[model samples]
Target: MTDVMRCEAVADIATPIGHAGRVSSPVAEFDPKRVRRLRRYTWWSVVPMASFYAILVITGLVNGFADGTYAAADLLVLGLVLLVLTVEATRFCASTMRGLGQGRHHGAEQAAAFIAALLTAGCVLATKPEYGFIWVLLPAILAASIVTNATVSLRWPLTFATCGSTAFVVATASWRYGPPMVPIRFALIAAAVVAFTIFVLVVAVWFWDVVLELDRARSVSAELAIAQERLRFAAELHDVQGHHLQAIALKGELAERLVGADDGAARAQAAEVAELARTALRDTREIVHGYRRSDLATELDNAREILEAAGIATTVSGHARSVAPPLQPLFGALVREGATNVLRHSRALHCEMSILTDEHGSEVVLRNDGVYASDGTSGSGIDGLRERFATLGGQVRAEHRDGWFELVGRAEEPGRSEA
Candidate 1:
């Protein structure tokens, strides 16, 4: 009964929006971390009243059992009151934890409050001589109302019922076949009861309102983060494509004009168009990837060194330097991929790479002298390589034949017509 509300973090532990006031079970739809935290908050919330009630009952029980004037009958009455309390307390707890729903179930909350108040009054009245002043149970029951959401509507009937029940308990005790306690004692108990009921219910409902507000704040924060990302994407896109598109339009107009007048010059302008397209594609990729961080020569050198250290003789001959600047990443990927295959699917003594360039195209042939039947298909890296090379009229292929594994690839000159 000496417990005061330590509401420092009560709002933080109140039900969040997702599982607020509508879960079918205690263990359902609740975050384990949050649930654990809520459980503690709930303990703190109820212990003050519940623990105080327990001490009051025990005081009544012991005082009754000690006095010879009220041994057997008062013991049986208090025992019956305990049974009713056990059932009502369980109901009250379930209602409190789940959060009493709104108007849809207002009747249940009313019934609970009225019945609990009557039972609490009965416990005190049962030991009238021993249980003095604890008649405050009547008003306490009225004030300890619960709600799942922050909505309170005062009903005149419920107010009448609670007040009437308190009066009935005090009147019955005063008018009973004995010298009654003074009138001031009844007034004090009635005043304490009414004051606590109002205080407890108001504070309890306000805590949950704060919880609902916090949930809304979290939702706003997430939406703001998403808006910031979209703005960044838009700004980067404008910066990358603005000048490139203007240059592409000029080159296209030049090619169109030359097509009728000078065929050779038009062909040259078309090649410039292909180069411009490649540059735009690269710019877009860089924006998405955060920046172009790989160079084919560097990757090839790293791959060759890695494979050689693994006790495999590696001969890398791909002239990544000969490929157009935009396509170097694809050749670099081929070198890295060849090294990975040698290490993972083959116990190879030798790995060889041949970079061949001709008038039509550039090809990288990666061959290793070990064959292990494997489920490793062209995985994400190879699929990405295929897409990247396809943008510039190129492709990659793989084969296994007689203890030899070969991956061969080519990216044709950009302006070359596919035959």
Candidate 2:
């Protein structure tokens, strides 16, 4: 629930109601109750405006009565007109809310709201002969809604234009009525226009900043993933290649010692050396191929060959066929990294490779029983392997205890083995 609340808040802030004329909110934050509340508030906007109209009617009645010209029939008619305008305003707000929440026809709702406000203003102006001061209520309510919403979409533009036109009409009507402060009223209208323009510019800048921030975040995430992949690749190369070279060097020295005493023995040892060299070449090619990162099965085969050439027994078991292609490289990378670690660090007589696949994707494990050095430092190989797996949204763990070492890598989904 807390996560949901946070997501809603982010969505509400990010979604822009720009010049597209659509009332688009962040889909993430949309809830039926929120829509209902918007509708309630929109309709509730009519209350203050209607109250002003009531005051106008009451004042008119009081003025007429003071001059002995007031009639109960005239007051009743004025009250009825106010009631009709209030209902229209309520309907317009309700429709706007429905459009906003349902992702329906927003443009139509905005048009309706504009039209209603304009008609109400025009009505007030037309009736100013009977209730002279009543005309002020329309522009006051328009300005209030504009300030309260803080929104500058199509509706706002329409609002600004409507209010400006209403001001022009009011000013003209006042001049005709010989009002003493007509010029002051025109000056206030000019100020409202300037303020609304400034509001529009501010909203545009805010929207641009939001888009830029989102792009920056995505770029940072991508860079981090690439860095992790590079590390894992380095670790894998160190582990696999390091052990193979060490064994070849050791075998060459042994062959040199037996060469002079017995020709046959010397030749046999030479053959072993030759075989080891061939195996090493094959393993190196496979590792390079892993830089391209082939399927899981291919990597498994290479791992087995590398282990066996190092005189370490290896066993692989489980269904190897159903793994998805996208995940193949990740699995292969895991196998390559694991085998390299075993050869360089484990010194185990036997190593086991097992793969299991079910509904959850796939799992690969490598374990060996060998002499694991207790030195509490990992070489560049292990560090590189860790970084690689992390890029693919996977993890690697190395454990050593009782002369056994285990390296495990698992990925949520397969990715390219090469960084």
Candidate 3:
């Protein structure tokens, strides 16, 4: 259950919502497009293993039928055994690819396949002892495939022992029933088949493991980036407020001391304290409102980066200098809010942003396609933006039309502010 939930969470982080683009979390910096590509690679990597398994299993069945020695009853029994083995092999491959547990039922299936392989090999040997060396490779390869995917605790030891035991058994049988050199030849061939099949299985599993590791690393890196950003913000806030707070404390102490000897001096000191407090309050508010770091160009670049990360094609145009210095921060806020809305409220695939300044005012227009059904409903973020823009005689408009959503914010020049 835990593994299933983890896979689902990774999928949520790496798969775009609605097959468009909707991020799981704004801070999770993953590209669903890249993840999807990796998924394709993982799928293709398993194809060779499945193909080889099928060919080997089919070869065993073909050789058994073409032997021309077995009676009808013997052939029928051989066919049934091979059929069971093929079905079990198919189930194991499907279960492994689908990430299903190799539980007791799987153990039972593996045992059954092992028994079927042994029975089929016995049938081949009993009918045509001379052909046993060639036909025995089939069961060896199949057992290797099953062992490679097994999750049993002692699987490695078990695999080595099983392969070694099979080689010895085949060699002993060959010696007992065939030419003297046949035992060594059959033993070497069995060992080689086991080794080659294990190699192929390991390579397939490695490719999938790499894909999963990449998926995990993507989420971890995103979380680390957010943590670093938060630390940086906290440090900046401390720098801004720490100095003013210390000075305010000293002034308050001095004012208390002066009150005993000189009322006028105490009053002036108190006034200084009040002014210091107000200055600190203003600086704190500026920090909170993003005035200290609200460069319109930076915000635009950030928006583009975020949208592209979410698999959205984003284009940001125009320069920060195009807007009046006083209105730059407002426009920056607009870009940030607009990009955030596109990520959180819509499944946008492409976004366009344009910032401009003219004789009349400064304006920014943001547009995106794949607007969600509820996109036009104003949220608290948009409401706050409207209030901020209104303070400078500006307005922000958001609307959805023709399957596109647009946000436009404009603030008039100081000359036209009163009018």
Give the winner by TM-score: 1 or 2.
Answer: 1
TM-score of each: 0.49, 0.30, 0.69
lDDT of 2 by residue, 1-419 (tens): 00012222332222111111222231221122332344354445433444554466567657865665546775566557556655543333233322222213345544454455445444544554555445445344433333323343544564556556656655655565556586347536634643453344334334333433443443333233333335555666677678777887877787788878877887877787788778777877655546443567666664564454344567898755666666676667677667766755664667888887665556777888875766787677667767876766777777875666777766655434442
Tens-digit per-residue lDDT, 8-94, candidate 1: 222322221111133121111112234345546764674345445646766667775787645687668656765565445434533
Candidate ordering by lDDT (highest first)? 3, 1, 2
Q: What ranking emerges by TM-score with the best candidate at the front? A: 3, 1, 2
Q: How accurate is candidate 1 locally (lDDT)?
A: 0.57
lDDT of 3 by residue, 1-419 (tens): 00111323433333211112333453333345565665576556543444555456456556656776555776576557656665665555544553312322456667666656655564566456745555454565556556656665656775776577667666766666667787778777776776676666556655656556655554353333334435656776899899999999999999999997998999999999999999999998776566785567766766665565455678777877888878877787788778778866776768999988887898999999967777336888888889999988889999887778999999986667558
Least well predicted 10-residue stretch by lDDT in candidate 2: 11-20
- Model 2 regions more than 4 Å off: 1-4, 8-76, 95-130, 138-153, 179-419
By lDDT, the best candidate is: 3
TM value for model 2? 0.30
Which is superior by lDDT, 2 or 3? 3
- Tell me the alpha-carbon RMSD of every candidate: 17.4, 20.2, 7.9
lDDT of 2: 0.53
Name the candidate that leads on TM-score: 3
